[model samples]
Target chain A: MRVLGVDPGLTRCGVGVVEGVPGRPCTLVAYYVVHTDPEDELPLRLLHLDRSLTDLVAEHRPDAVAVERVFSQHNVRTVMGTAQASGIAVLAGARAGLPVQTYTPSEVKAAVTGSGQADKAQMTMMVTRLLRLPEPPRPADAADALALAICHVWRGGTRSKLAAAAERARGGRTR
Target chain B: MRVLGVDPGLTRCGVGVVEGVPGRPCTLVAYYVVHTDPEDELPLRLLHLDRSLTDLVAEHRPDAVAVERVFSQHNVRTVMGTAQASGIAVLAGARAGLPVQTYTPSEVKAAVTGSGQADKAQMTMMVTRLLRLPEPPRPADAADALALAICHVWRGGTRSKLAAAAERARGGRTR
Candidate 1:
């Protein structure tokens, strides 16, 4: 399955596309950052982000979209911007008729680096090794986006398998 | 000027349209609530909201859009949802090339009721009286939305006047 992951932010939104099956190495389809000027008005900034994300989704055409869930932080203003950006990202996926999922930062870190508390360097290293890239992805946001996509692909696969197995078990009991 | 006011929420978004100039009783053109099932997935709920707000803007063709500025609250989850909803509302206005302005709850209260700390009942009462409506607008959200629109109209007018006065003073001094 191919998945698009978004690490949503107003100033810099990271987007990464990955193609792979569960329990296998993933291939990097593409990755980029969408930037908006902080000096611009809030509405204009949001509009630019919405359009950029819409175009990105159309170009990649991933099977599913995954976004990093925004959490409240001590910096209220920054968190608000992040939440707004993530909202636009989720709308982009839904508008394209694709299933969208959100994972916490820890979830992505655990999925990619085998530890929920892994540091940025560790996540970047793991992502580089897993994707067999010669160099690590620049900007921690990009690495986080890749981690989110990888997490969704693996978790989505496992969830479906578990559901199927449960159904089979129930059928056998009924029979 | 005609203004569209949005009090953004995920479950029930309040929208109100008003037409009038500053220093005059505003006329309420329309007011309604957009509802979304809370049980529905986040993306679907947001998509429904986006479409509803978009359609409302297109139909009303307001000169400006006013939205309540979301603030951080004790309930982090609710605040996040509010921020997200407000983001979509702002996008609706920006996409339509209308000037969008956000006013804090206190600002709206001060503009309508002459007190920043006015309670919900006071706000509703003042809005009804200001618009010359026979009854109070239902569902506190609707009243708050109307207050936002009223606030924008008056504030926008006053702000421009202040700018022009400052410009004239500067021109005189420079000459």
Candidate 2:
């Protein structure tokens, strides 16, 4: 499965595409940090993000999308921007007819680094090794996006399999 | 000027269209409550809102749009949904190439009822009177959408005049 991971934000949205199966190691197909001017109007900033994300979806054509879920923070303004960016990400996926999944920060960390509370460096190191990259992706957001995609490729695939198995078992019992 | 006002939400998004100048009392052209199934997936729910908002904008062809700004709340989950919905509203306006403005609940209430802290009944009563409606609009969200449109028609026009005057003054001094 090819999955796109989005760490949604107004100023800088991180996107990473990964290709792999559930139990196999995933490779990074592409990654980008889409930047928008903070001085721009809110709608314009959001528009830029929207267009960039839409273009990325068109280019990669991922099977599923994974986005970082917005959580409450001390700064309500910051959280609002994050939430807005996240909404755009989800909308982009929906527009492309792709199933989009949300993963919390901890969930992505746990899936990538085997610990929910792993530090940025640790998570980066794990992603690099897992993807067999020569160097670690920088600025944390890029690496985090890769982690999200990797997490979803594994987690979502497993969940689908389990759901299918459960359905089959129920049908067998009824018959 | 024709204006579209949106009260963003997950289950029910209120939309109202009005037409008038700053000093003149605005008339409500149309209003509707866009509803989505609570059991639907998040993406589908958002897609429904996106399409409905898009259709409304295309049908009315508003000169501007007013969306309720998402504010901080004690319930993080609820606030996230509101923020997401607000983003969708803003995006819809942007996609339609209309100038989008956001008004806080207090700002809308104050503009319509002379008090920022006006209760729902007071705001509804003022909206009904302002729009010359036969009775209070059902489902408070619809009334609030009208209130937002009224606030923008009055306040946005005043702000535009002030901005234009400032520009004139600046040009005179600079030249």
Candidate 3:
């Protein structure tokens, strides 16, 4: 299955697309970051994001999408902007009829790095190793997006295998 | 000056464009809600947002953009999604080289309704009244975005005027 992962941000949003089935390792198809100017008005900034994201979607044509859930702190202003960015990602996925899934930061980290508390650098290294990329994905956000996709693959695969096993057992009993 | 307001969301991102200068009532130039499907993959969703927003910006070239600043809460998942949406708005504005400004929800309500505690209905009523619209802007999100733009006009105008006056005073004395 093809999966696209996203790390949404106001100034810079990361996107990664990978293709693979449930049981096999995935191949990195594409990855990039969408950036906007800090000084521009919010509407225009959102416009830029809308266009860039649309382009990425049309190009990659992934079957599913995964995004990192936001984790907010004391900065209300920052959190709000981040939320807007995330909304765009979700909306885009919905419009295209793709199954969108969200994962928390810790869950994504643990799935990729085998540790929930892994830092940015660690996650980047792990993503690189797992994908067998020649070089680490530039911009931490892109790497994070890739990791989220990997996590989805791992979890999705496990679930499907279990389901298949149950089906086989039921068939044997009937025979 | 023209101001564009955005109420960023994952499913329906409301956008309102208005034209006005300091001390002048703003005119609604255009307004619409951009939507994306929730089922699509994250990257495709973002791509849709980017394309739609870019079209909106191109159709209506506003001088300034105003957006609501996100406030923090206990819900980590909600906060994260909101932040992502906000980030897209910021980036879109920056890419277009428009001056982007952010306002807190309370600040916007206070400016429009003369009370920070005003609820959505009250705020919508006030926004319609202030803009001289026949009815409140359709969809709560659009009204909220329009209110944000009005707030910026009311507040940002005064600040700019004062700065200009100060600059003139200094220039006169020096000359």
Most accurate candidate by lDDT: 1
- Name the lDDT value of residue A69 in candidate 2: 89
lDDT of 3 by residue, B114-160 (tens): 89999999998987887899988888889988887788788865664
Kindly give the stretch of ten consecutive residues in candidate 2 chain A with the minimal lDDT sum.
A166-175
- Candidate 3: global Cα-lDDT? 0.75
lDDT per model, in order?
0.88, 0.87, 0.75
* lDDT by residue (tens digit), candidate 2, B1-175: 8889999998889998898888789998999999978877777788889999999999999988999998777367688887888899999998887778888899998899999999999999998998999988989899999899999899975675676598788883221
TM-score values for chain B across all models: 0.89, 0.90, 0.86
Put down candidate 1 lDDT per residue, B1-175, tens digits, no spaces. 8999999998899999999898888999999899888877799899999999999999999988999988787477688888899999999999998878888888898999999999999999999999999999998789889898889888864664565598788883321
What DockQ, on C-alphas, does every prediction get? 0.68, 0.70, 0.32
User: How big is the positional error of residue A145 in model 2, measured in Å on the Cα after superposition?
Assistant: 0.8
* Candidate 2, A1-175: lDDT as tens digits: 8999999888889999999998789998999999888877677778789899999999999988899988876466688888889999999998898878888999999998889999989999999999999999876788989999999988975774576598688883321
Quality of candidate 1 docking, DockQ: 0.68
Report the error of model 2 at residue A65, Å: 0.6
lDDT of 3 by residue, A21-140 (tens): 664677898899999889764656677776787678778887767877765753566665666777677666656766677789899888887899999999999889888999999988
Model 1 residue A152 distance off true place after TM-score fit, in angstroms: 0.9
